[model samples]
Target: MMTKTKLPNKKLAIPKKKIAPKFRDAFIRFYRYMIFFGGRGGSKSTHIAILLLSRMMTDEYMYLVYCRKWSAHIKDSQFKIFQDCVKMMGWQDEFKFNQSDYSFVCLRNGNRAVAKGLDDNQKTKSIAEPTHIWVEEADQMTFDDFDTLNKALRSLKTQNSFILSFNTFINELHWIRTTIFDKEQQYELSEQFRNMDTYLNHSTYLDNPFINQEEYLQTLLMDNGGNESKIASDRYGLWGQMPNENPWLYAFDKEKHVRVIPFIPSYPIYLSFDFNKNPMTVKMFQMSPQKGLYDSFVHMIDEMEGTVVLREFCERIKAKYPFSPFFVTGDSSGQKKGEVGYESKHDSAYSMIKKHLGLSDKQMNPNGYNLTYENSRILMNQMFYNYPNLYIHPQCKVTINECEIATVDEKSMNVHELKKDRGTYAMDHFDNMRYFFQKYFQEFARSNYHATK
Candidate 1:
């Protein structure tokens, strides 16, 4: 809309950068969606006004609106910073604040902006299409909410844009990821935030050199140039999770491996088996990414032996999934030849289990299971962060609990992705997870770049 592809990058060298007003101008001039996330005490609001003012000056009295979920929260411009930006920019007579009624600059060009709320999001289209929209604490709102109201601001032409500003917090499971994180899926994602970063060059309280170091920031990182994560999530406009999140912990995150009891035969089934000693276990992972699957939970009993023999496990799995693909992976611990006891039980488990269960050699191969512990971590992280449809049956209660509580190796501090470090006692249950993940990741890795659903 500004006829410019790139607004000039902000003055990175400037210290004590309190020019939020200047930053706002930059955001509106550059792109359609701008998000400003700054550290505590950063002049976030100051930047908003300046950017809004920039739109007004360039678009010439474009219809603008000052928004807040609650009307009472709007603060006074009783300070010089606000007074200076408003008066210095020659908008001295543009604002009218009487008791609770607040309205500013209702002009077509150099005009006024109405006071509005999310309750009336769709109702915000009386004037020309909005050139820009600003959202604070966008994390609190849903994707559906943004869509319902924000899109109504689209102008008849192209000057329309939206701005999002918020302090960092939990809620990383955001809907914006489809739009901001991956641009190609704009059709599936809301278009409101499609180009947010182009306009938002990231903001932090420290970026405002106007903040006095001695009086504001000092020995502590908050007062000084420290606290990297907070700074990144808040100022850099990155989506982040808070420390208090339960999923953030490595040890308590796994779902206990419990087998589902009330098995429902609704969809085609697949069994990815990983046999183990003592536990003598097999898991039935349901493949339903698009369509919801049964509540296939798992149970990891402390007990080793059970009537549910390896043969029965296989037969039951086959009975459930009949004629569908049932992929299997093993330790191959027994497959190795020339051991001290070459014919030992450890070596024969794979063949014995498969033979008893009637699995064909083609159905059980080492194709996708040839990865190490480190490989598992990378694969899991990808699945968790990138894939949304992965699930275990609710009956796999033990599996889910175990997975949620599963911990990475102590030294490596991950599921098994070791760089230079290594740890003892390889994760037993975690190792078993390879079967399902292998099938999923292998399929994903081969055609992911060209994937379409």
Candidate 2:
């Protein structure tokens, strides 16, 4: 016969001073849901464990569910974290652990803390009625996992609450906003999280006064790269977007390449046009002849386009830049036989634009008439990064945004199809700008060097 020992019956008594200011409310507040999201070393798990232990001591019928994405992770992670909290609070004797069952039972009360790996369906079926639930490494769990767990909680006959904690380093696709908190999905969210009372808190290492500053600095130095998004997420407790691997304008960095410059009336304004029925696009640029590509700047001051006929767009530009001399460059497609606003196909886009704006043939840069889209993009990206000669006025918000976020398709390996719909056709504005550079200033670096030498 094997001898068995019964666990002692005692209630946990935690010191009031042990609870940090950041988590002081965790001990008292029984919210429907509490979200603690941010960087590492915030003591998010530690504080929640202490709060769960406190509740178990008070509510004899309470069943606390501590869950993770995988069952194997529970023993080494959340299970140990909770055990440490119990020991730290000098309540080791007050709780009895069953390693086989993976649970901690309160000696004084019948309340138990169960470790569940959501990966096992059998474990989910075993949770009869839970009063409190904690999901650790929540980013690892899918939206479906959350929904299923929520439905299970409703089956319980008690007023239960949930706690979700995660590090903000997951893909934007799996982000919490896309699933639960989207304003567009408010009806579904409200129905699911009834009375949807939610408390959100973001914490960082700096929020923990006991954090080692030296260790943080060392870690930052080791991980420092061009990955600004990762640093923002890991250090500042912010929602960060990863850099697009196939960004259309891979060279355009707003911090390094963007600048604000006033349009000078004395300099001749260079114009590039792209014609489409819904929305025509145009960009105004001016180049510096005296400075080398590395030292010079290409100032793009204005943009003008609308859905009206070519005649109306031409009239708008002529009226806007009345005094400035316009030098134009555009796609050869503009010169093709098409009835833009005339009786016959012979009356092309160029003929109408030239006639309406009063632009002479000599004023146009014909070099871009046969320029390939691929070649133009190459020149544009090169100038934007290596030469570093481009600048745009703060007034051109649409152009700036299109240049930054436009992406190429991974399968086709081309940039013509941007990821999001380029509504209002603003992405064409960037193409027009690229054409203007290739037409006029693409060879400035080599020419200037030869002239100086």
| RMSD of every prediction | 19.0, 14.0
TM-score of each: 0.45, 0.49
Alpha-carbon error at 129 in model 1, in Å?
Answer: 3.9
Q: How do the residues 63-110 of candidate 2 rate in per-residue lDDT, one tens digit apiece? A: 888999888888888888878998888888779988886898988767
lDDT of every predicted structure (CA atoms): 0.48, 0.70
Clashing pairs in 2: none
Q: Whole-model lDDT for model 2 versus the true structure?
A: 0.70
Best of the candidates, lDDT: 2
Cα lDDT, model 1, residue 209 = 57
Instruction: Give the alpha carbon lDDT tens digit for every residue of 249-306 in model 1.
Output: 1323234222333334563334444444334455555444442124322222121122
**Among all candidates shown, the one with the greatest TM-score:** 2
Total backbone collisions for each predicted model: 70, 0
Candidate 1 stretches greater than 4 Å from native = 1-30, 75-84, 87-90, 97-99, 106-110, 119-128, 182-197, 218-239, 243-252, 255-453
